[model samples]
Target: MNDPYDNCMAACDACAHAYDACTAAYLAERDAQALADCIALDIECAQLCRFASGAMARRSVLTPSVCALCAQACDLCAAECQRHAHDHCRRCALACEACAAMCRAVA
Candidate 1:
């Protein structure tokens, strides 16, 4: 069955993955000290996206609220990622932007 929130859930999941991958890329080779804010935001955004996805999957009452926050987090992550020149960051930014739009639709 196709759930009404399936698209939002997928977007949230993909956003979380993108943020995680971006963070991993930063930790692996990027200068952690210089990009500390980006790293922190990525972690927060990833967690929020995951939580939002779970809420939707479970059909929680707080899904709207969770998705709203997740959208904000995605926006923040996208802005931070856009500030960087790395390929991972660029990709993550795109993912984040897409996720935010999906989340807003549900919110």
Candidate 2:
């Protein structure tokens, strides 16, 4: 995918990895409300990171705008995940923070 985003690739990987972790947590925790919320945010952040990474990869004109939105989402998702103490939540928060930082760099 055009080598992905040099600046965003790590964040993209983090988001993707966090999504998997969130899914596993959802399955393990089974707390419909909180886990579901975390899972939903994880999925959203992952998808956005993927899209933003792809956009950056293609050097699209819309990348800046996309990155802006990515930063926002990642920030919110990170905050949400950080509210909990679970390992998965902590990992997700870290990933989101990384993604947010990358997005901010290019936004």
Candidate 3:
């Protein structure tokens, strides 16, 4: 069977990448609040991506809803990242955008 989890995994990868970038950026700039927010979102998105991927892989009925939530999270994360004009934020925005697309597709 073709893997539906492919998209989920992609989202997961993007989320994780974005999360790392945001964390690094926050740490570098010492923007504690932004760093905290990004980390929280990143953690949430990462877990969602992992769950969505695993659920999809197992053909769980909850995949769509989970993907939907992932989409929302990615969107928010992207918006937040876009506020800063740094490389890390740019990268995070891109990843979040990609993840959002993937999540929308799955959802």
What TM-score quantifies how close candidate 1 is to the native fold? 0.95
Candidate 1 Cα misplacement greater than 4 A, ranges = none
Candidate 3's residue-wise lDDT over 8-89, tens digit each?
Answer: 6766676776677677667777557756876677667667767766777778898889888878888888898888787878
Q: What TM-score goes with each of the models?
A: 0.95, 0.86, 0.81
Off by over 4 Å in 3: none
Which of the two, 1 or 3, has more lDDT?
1
What tens digits encode model 2's per-residue C-alpha lDDT throughout 1-107?
A: 44436858667766877877776767777566657776787788888888888888788999999999999998999899888888888888888888898888888
| Superposition error at 89 for model 1 (Å) | 0.7
Stretches > 4 Å off in candidate 2: 1-4
lDDT of each: 0.92, 0.82, 0.76
Q: Candidate order by lDDT, highest to lowest?
A: 1, 2, 3
Question: Number of clashes in every candidate structure?
Answer: 0, 0, 0
Q: Candidate 1, residues 2-63: lDDT per residue as tens digits? A: 88899999989998899999988898874688888889999999999999999998999999
Q: How far is candidate 1 from the true structure (C-alpha RMSD, Å)?
A: 1.1
lDDT of 3 at 82: 89
